[model samples]
Target: MNACIVLCLALTAFLANAVAQYETCVADTAIVTGGTPGVTVSIGRDEANEMVQITLVGPSDVWFGHGFDGLVMANNYGFIVDTSGVSERRFGTGYSVPTELATTSIVGTPETSIVGGDRTVVIERPYSATDA
Candidate 1:
C-alpha cells in the first residue's frame, strides 16, 4: 500500500543518513500517507555522537513498521512498532514474520508514548552497528 511505502521511505532515508553528516547534520521530516490519520516521520542526525534519531507517530489502533534497504521482505531489515513500543530489530527473507537479530544493535534505549489515540516511537542508533 502507499502508506506502507511512505513509511518504508522514511527508513530508506534514514539508511542514507548513515553517511549523511558530511557537514552539519540537519533534521528532516515528512508527513507519511496511507494511515487514516497519517503518520509523521522525523529524522535527526547527531554528528558529534555519530547517531541518528528517528521518530514515528501514527495511529495507535493499528501496528506499523519501518523496513529499510529493500522494497520487498527478502533479506529486508526492519522493526515493528506498536503502542507499547519496539521489542527488537528483525531481519527477514520472506513475507512471514522476521526473526530478532542475534545481537542487539540499538546504540541506546528507545522511548515510546501513546496519547490521544496516537502512538509515538523514537529510536536512536549509531551510524553503524554498536560494538560487540
Candidate 2:
C-alpha cells in the first residue's frame, strides 16, 4: 500500500476575509505500485481555485486517478490523467463517466527527462466543509 502524505490548512475565516491571499491547503505525496508500474503521486490544493491538484509521475502509458474515499469501486468521483496529456473528470456507479474539466490550464508539461515521465492534473472543486 502506498503511503499518502496529506497536508491540510484550514482558513475559512481568513479566506472569507482575504480571498486574494491564497494559501497552501493540502499537500500530499505517495508512492504507488500495482498496475502500470509504480508512480509517484503528489497532491495539493490551489487556494485560488479552492481545488485539489494532483501530479502523477510514472511511465508514459500509465493512467492515474483518485477518489474521495478509499473505495476503488464505482459511484466514486475522481480525475484521470492520461499519457496523451489530457485530464478527465470521471464519475459513475460501476464504471467511469469522463468529462473534460478544464482544457486550457489543467495539465502541465510532461517531465520526460525523468525515468518514466510525469503529468500534473489540477482538479477544480470546492474545499471540504469539515476538516477530516
Candidate 3:
C-alpha cells in the first residue's frame, strides 16, 4: 500500500512537470493607418523553458517620433493553473519601440502561453497632427 502511494505521488509529479514543460514564443506584426493599429497574433508551444514570447514589428517608417503607446492582451489560450494548482490566467501590457518597432511581453509564472487564442497586440501610436 505504501508503494502504491509513492507511485501515485510520482505520477502526479510527472504530470506536473509535463504540463510545465510546454512553452511558446511567437512574433507578430501590426499595421497602423488611422488610430490604434493592431496585428494578428498567434502563440504556440516550442520548448519547455519559454512558454510564450511575442514580438511586434512595426510598419516600415511608422515612427512614433517621441515614443509609442501599446498594449498586449492574452484573453484566453490554455493552461490556467500550474502544478500546485494556482490561477494562471495572467494578463499584461507594456510599451514598444521608439521611432521604430514596438514589443511587449505578457510574462507569467510557469511560462504559460498567452491567453485569448487569437491574441491582439494593439499599438496605439501617439497622435500626429502633421500627418492629418
Q: Which candidate number has the best lDDT? A: 1
lDDT tens per residue, model 1, 1-132 = 999999999999989977445332333333323423456667777777787777777778988766665655567566678756675555655576677677766756687888998888877777777321
List candidate 3 segments past 4 Å from native: 26-41, 48-132
Candidate 2, 25-131: lDDT as tens digits: 43444432343445455556656656555555544556666544445535544455565654445355655554444433343443333342554443433454221
Superposed by TM-score, candidate 1 places the C-alpha of residue 107 at a distance from the truth, in angstroms, of 3.2
Q: Report the lDDT of model 3 for residue 80.
A: 22
**Which lDDT value does model 2 have at 8?**
22
Could you tell me every candidate's TM-score relative to the true structure?
Answer: 0.63, 0.45, 0.22
lDDT of 3 by residue, 1-132 (tens): 999999999999999877633233334423224433533333455353534333332223332111123333322221222223222122333342212113222344222233443222322121121221
lDDT for 111 in candidate 2 is 37
Q: What is the alpha-carbon RMSD of candidate 3 to the true structure?
A: 15.8
- lDDT for 20 in candidate 1 is 44
Give model 3's clash tally.
9
In model 2, residue pairs whose N, Cα or C atoms come closer than 3 Å (at least 3 residues apart or on different chains), thus clashing, are 75-92, 75-93
lDDT of 1 at 17: 74
lDDT of each: 0.66, 0.47, 0.32
Clashing pairs in 1: none
lDDT of 1 at 15: 92
